[model samples]
Target: MPDSAGILPLPLFSSSLKRDTSRPVMLIGFQHQGNLGLGYLASTLREHGYSVLTCDFEAETSEIIESARQSKPMIVGFSLIFQFYIRKFDALMQALRAAGVDCHFTIGGHFPSLSHEETLRMLPELDSVVRFEGEMTLLELADVIGTGRDWHDLQGIAYRGTTGVVTNPMRSLVDDLDSLPYPERNFEPEKALGRKALPLLASRGCARTCSFCSIQTFYRTAPGKIVRTRKPAKVIEEMQAMHEERGISIFLFQDDDFPLFGPVWRRWAYDFVDCMHRSGLAQRVIWKINCRADAVEPEIFTAMRDAGLYLVYMGLESGNEEGLKTLHKQVSVEQNIRAVEMLKQVGLLFEFGFMMFDPGSTLESIKQNLRFLRTILNDGCAAAVFCRMLPYDGTPIKDELERAGRLLGDVCAPSYDFLDPRVSKMYNSLSQIVDVWGWIHGYRALSPQLNWAWNEVAIMERLYPGIDGLEEYRRRLAAVTKKSNDVLFSVMDNLLEVAEFDAAERWDNARLDALRREFLEELLRERDAFVEHNQSTMLRVLRAQPVQEAASA
Candidate 1:
């Protein structure tokens, strides 16, 4: 039953706000990596009979303005995913206004909702900021705009009144996950290997309050249930529909905590596994999920693997006890190691989020983090990757840094100085080396390409099993990965030695540059060889398979 807003009685949208039903709403947001934020808002509006248009936030300003002109929507919404991109949004919106594409402009997401006044100050052209849980609120805003009524008193919104910005009372979070319509797929589905891939959500919100993460803060500040999950049957139904109707074989579970954390959620996981087996979808498709390190128990993960769980992404954010405590991760260093071991034992392909540098970082912590990465990745189980943590808006870490007077940089790119200055210099050198070889320009870089190629081989082995030379290919891929990891470890170790000795002036830039180039050349050559030989072979097997058949079939 919907409230007076003609949508579910979720927080934000009011019953008094009614749309014309025929008015078109336009949304502009980052579409990369299956952005379901805008997808849900678009779907909700469509459910209530309002036409919707979507434009990628990365599109050129002229292209976006052209889209607005062509669509002529009653209201144009912007999905601001990060506060760092505020300047980009400002310039684009300012351009749109100058071009006289004068539909109502609204922005929504973590930064805007948490700091609405600051957002308004940053992007003055925006008419309203749709605070947390925006489905109903956006629809109601559309309805009011369509009917030419005053939207000043709308709840779950912040707008500039005659005097200043007025924020309406916060709305309750949507209590039920199953009531909402499936998000509209406004873009082409992504692919894993050669199989069609899509991201699905079984739940919304996270229970943990990690200081560096905003997910908890985003859901906690809102009024309703914090971590609502759909029933197992409902989740399976969507998976089945996608598998049967859309030829999707890869399911990427985008849940913040993947509903697999504790005893209560373990029961939910078992039920979900049971449903997967009963529906026979488990045999046909492979899926992945993101969960906390503590959630990775051997028994339940084994069951999940049997039910088509292919990968697990854990937020193993830090390596040492002090680092974990600083980030408020709650889980210990031993727990993190145990979880990784458990995943390996269950035969799950695992990836992790590791922060090698943070405000609390010291020389000893840096050494410990590096050692941890080598311990995990020396065997070529997963690619070695690490990065510095940024203090994004709405996170407790950022607030803490501000209070400590340690925060540097602006909202566009929030950063902080490490407690030890030498650690900063070491990090900078490490960054320079990795940026040259690992992750600068995406596929053209070494580490990312290596990871992608490794993932492809893993997926191929699982999807099209018994392909000739597959094991040999896997062995060779592991060799390539190990070689690259060794070089990374070596380079970082040298930089750490330099930092330890305070040899700042004699940095040996030429030697490091040569090493980077030589390693990159070798890595790319190996990667290209693997792709050339194996990719087409796997594709041929895929092409030979019958349509709508199980992977093992």
Candidate 2:
């Protein structure tokens, strides 16, 4: 039990028997992109003398059970990153329990942290939730569980109490992000054209309050500074170490909003760029970041480009003013266009998050969005992509929809209808079409594959510059991409027309499928040919050999 100061007294070790430190604490989560949340938690626990093991949640049930049977973990924690996976995780939890691995179960992430009551009710297997900013909280929970002490009074925890689900007071956010150790990377680094790419964070939280995003609210609800940044020197030091030790050449900044927000952070960005140059890493590595459209100013962005900024991902959530206003993006359509133009002007590549359909969307608005995509993507600077805005949990838009009694679907997959029923029909059909062909991971997706091929060309331009046919390869890839974009826009145009006339049934999907197939075949053939032609260069790059300038152009 905790004392009057609300802190638990140290657990006294038994004279005869001590807690077995061999029993590890297991963390299970979706490790598709190397989940930093679990990485930080594992590192934190290890820092305080605890053994940690992790398993991908997508692993087979039998495999997970086998691992648990072998490791015999004392506690099993789930990283419930998104609500969509709630049902899946519940199934895993049930399976683990049925296998007789009766360890203390716990979960964490945005959904469980924000809606603890519902989470507790949904996954009754959980012993507690290590809520927002889980490093210290999880560490404390591990200590108490290891020593067999009661943890009901622990801050930043929500558990099933006697009367109901009781959420204790939240812990303050970590003030100095630099104080925390680097995330323990257990998964393989992502590859961008034979160059190793790893995700890095320069800051913790975002300052903007986009209606559809819970990041701002997640940090604001906590009891500390909203956004905390590590010093540029420390960030460079980490980069230097990773580059020297791991041969990592690409860094993906996964900050919610990178520290390029306003005047204060502009200075930080400059300092970061300067550090990159001073540490001599500016020319050695390239990186990408996610930022708002309005944050893409010319001077700073160009400076960033000079300092290894290869790609920028802007949240251009909407095309028109009305849609932007509804999404609370606080930026105009012109600004979005200008941001793309500025990126192009400075010779930096970019991708964007565009919502073609929102709650207030109509046929006209959808068409406006289509035109906007054309405006930016006509040159084939990047792949054409768009998605319906999802009203995720703890977002203002979710609350707004709930108050108006328009929110539909289950909590795991919440959705709503557009204002017009015809628009709904249109979107429903469009979504099916996209899922078939244009979706990033769709079976027939062509644009993203081409986009990746183009990314390889770009990477080669930097790392293997002056290769014999690099320029020609880039030009051919660009032409193929522009043609693919043309096909996408044509299909969208036909869909819009069909929806307007209420003839979605008559929409010729066979013709579109044939076109996508042709492009996909061509893409594969072209990529294979290029690889065969550049066999020596490809082999050298794939083997991670030192880059050497070719004899001649």
Candidate 3:
């Protein structure tokens, strides 16, 4: 439509390897280690007459980059879902550049789609960023880029030029999902991928706004504004195929919002769970789904658990009213509490996410949050994650924070290297907040930080003056904290280093316990120093508050 015939990027396939119409163009769909976006992109690529190469970003960035060069693919795409994966994306892009290879380096996923400008700014090596619904955009891109024409004119793509940033309008949402091909796993059907669990999306987009969120913003990409999902039977078919084909036993429902309609969700949950259970598929397969905290009912929980539901990922983003109010999360704390209790009593395991930092938070508000966790989920059945608020540019909250001048001018930072020279120690304070939130929440919300950890929180809050009583909560969060930390760390560690997981498994029993104790000791030492440092810092911030307010006024 827009003179794209001439502007498309060219694909660089191996010269020795003759191109055949039957030989599908290679589509590289990569996500981080043991990730499920792996499923989404891989499946779609295979459907559109393309062979797919899949890999994890956990391999050294150089490794991922080098592999692309060696494979000499037609298209190399990275799944930039997490903010931390930016460095790896750049590394791969760089490798493509170094080889002078014509491989089309593309990125399109939840995180990148929302922040296309950021992607352009950060990873120039990427030829372009697909703004939304990558399966189609990628398909069309491969056709155009491989043909050496005007993919730059294609809709829903973001590329740059001497003139400036060129952002093609988002393509209309796909109306008919039934005809879409199933998600393709990367490896051969004969190979066993072992028992690592992953999340899969049956639908695209969320319809609700839980304050401290970007879900609603993500939903806006679809033109008509409706959550689209595959038929329930097809969902079952995909799972069945994966189980039979790839030996995949566990699946996570990665929908922005599963069962957007309450009644529909109930009906689907009942039918699907019962169906899976009846067919004996549930025996071999377990699932984890993401849904509105309030959408789940006692019956749904019961049916889900009976159907071998391993976990239901919940977004409890906050414990109190104030935090929920800020994000406009459209649900109540009571609803959250009720939903959580039902899941627990129904024998369902849940991983609920909570956020501590907010734009207008006060000391009392923050404490109320900690107290909520302390009071509510202090057991093994449910968990809480405490993440910080990132000023995602497309999120409603981001708009609010930006207007209030609390939004960080630059939300983009260096990609986290969990195994890097400097940063493997911990994510920056913001990212630490994210991981710690998950860590603490993972142990069932009642988990406390070690003495030293709490002490550190206290000291930081004091120094920062707005973070509230983290040190105090850390101290109180003891047994549950230790166990929760272990659970959260262990799951993540297993997921992060699956190849070395076997070696790590040997120490799981005693070694995990020992690590917990060792972590506790480290927290204790850190806590003492934290107290002294924050105490002085708190006094300074307090004394300056009056002057700060006056200057702003």
Candidate 4:
């Protein structure tokens, strides 16, 4: 075991005119819970013959400052992903400045990739923000710093001096993704921030540009570059590393749309399946990956399952055909239905990530979505994790929201939690929908108290109760959910006293089991309730439609 010292040393670079010295580059992965970027970059840097250290940004403000004090490098990089993490990173730098620790600070990832200019303006302690794909840019930046050479030579950087943001053009995308080292095999995973399911990146950039997306915009920052992926051999190498080094077989593929780009991905999938067999990896492990509805063809979906993909996270963003069309989803309602059915036919498990309410959607539209979801869920692949449309900085929706004055203050990039005010405001709408939805399904496996409260209301209203309007219904549901969460947390707290698992693992298997059961139970009651409401609403609306048509006729 090595000390923090020499981990990211800023050895004064001896010029090539005198002698060449090694430059130490520290790749800081973002957030307290598992870092994929730094892990990848750490291995990348080490391969390039640079000293590298990877660390997670913790809640303790002193953590970065303390680490900086202990091992100050030529370049201190923070692997920023979400917008909230950027704010937290700013605070970390402020803490460091307060404590008198001055080291060259930098950041990269999704948020910074889009808002590098604003990031530099807001966070004064930051030296530069890497704009595009970071692996090469970061290495070059550290090289310049270690040598104390000209800053102008570095590409893909946004830095501030007396004149303010000096933006450099981003480097071209890595031509060959297969040439890069695997992050898991190259760096450490299954450690730090209490995450066991190693998050892996199979590819970079995206193929589609739906109106609500930022990935399309961000990827285009480096023009003419198509989405790139590592060879299947490399992907399996990382999995093998996870299995061998961390004993982690399960993974979460954090790709934007993994399976969509047909032939390239299929090659990787076949190689992956071959490696899984050759390496003797666990057959039962769940490796979840997300893809667009049109990406999973029946044959390809079957190939994926053959390769040991246990779960496919489908972003059936909206159930309504018009809503999907409005969002430029490119896939039709029929295509989505077929995709889900394909996954089911292959005997693979999956869950729905749905957006029931679009910005312009009304109550009627929501009911239509409910009917659509009911048909989809009828096949039993409907464990819903509701997500509202997130407006990223460079996305078209963000621009639209800004023009309409609906967006407030740097509300584009989501923070570390992926739930900022802008998005969470929508989440508030989602919560309302969830409550109504929960009332219909009983909120089982989702929110226990909500189920209990809704059930009580149902029982009360049935047994000779007056009308409990929306407000009264909401207040009672809130109280029930609050009480349920409190009891669950308290029980867990007592168990923790006697438990041997660390605080991070405390949120693992047992907790997930408890949460899931509660959610399912609550949802069962909610489903029945939803059915009743939906049928009534649909009949009324259907009758009204014919009457309006008759009048027009």
Index of the highest-lDDT prediction: 1
Q: Which ten residues in a row have the lowest lDDT in candidate 4?
A: 12-21
> Which candidate, 2 or 3, has the higher lDDT?
2
- For all candidates in order, the CA lDDT equals 0.82, 0.82, 0.58, 0.60
Tens-place lDDT per residue, model 1, 385-425, is: 77788898889999999999999999898899888888988
lDDT of 3 by residue, 337-380 (tens): 88878876775656667775555454455556766665565552
- Model 2 TM-score is 0.92
Alpha-carbon runs more than 4 Å astray in model 3:
1-35, 187-196, 380-384, 414-515, 518-553
Ranking under lDDT, best-scoring first?
Answer: 1, 2, 4, 3
Displacement of residue 193 (Cα, Å) in model 3 is: 15
Per-residue lDDT of candidate 2, residues 1-553 (tens digit): 3334333333333334233344579999988778989988898777656689999998898999999999988899999988998989899999999999998998989998888888999997889988899998887777667767787898999999889988899999999998888988888888755578888889998889799998887898889999999999999999987787787888889999889978999999999999999998898888889998889999999999888988888999888888999989899999999999999898777878888889889889988998999899887667777778899989999999999998999889899977788788777776666544453445347767877786676677666553567667766777777787787777678777877885545435566677777777877888778766876775565455433211100
Please say which candidate is ahead in lDDT: 1 or 4: 1
TM-score of 3: 0.69
Backbone clash count, each prediction separately = 3, 0, 28, 27
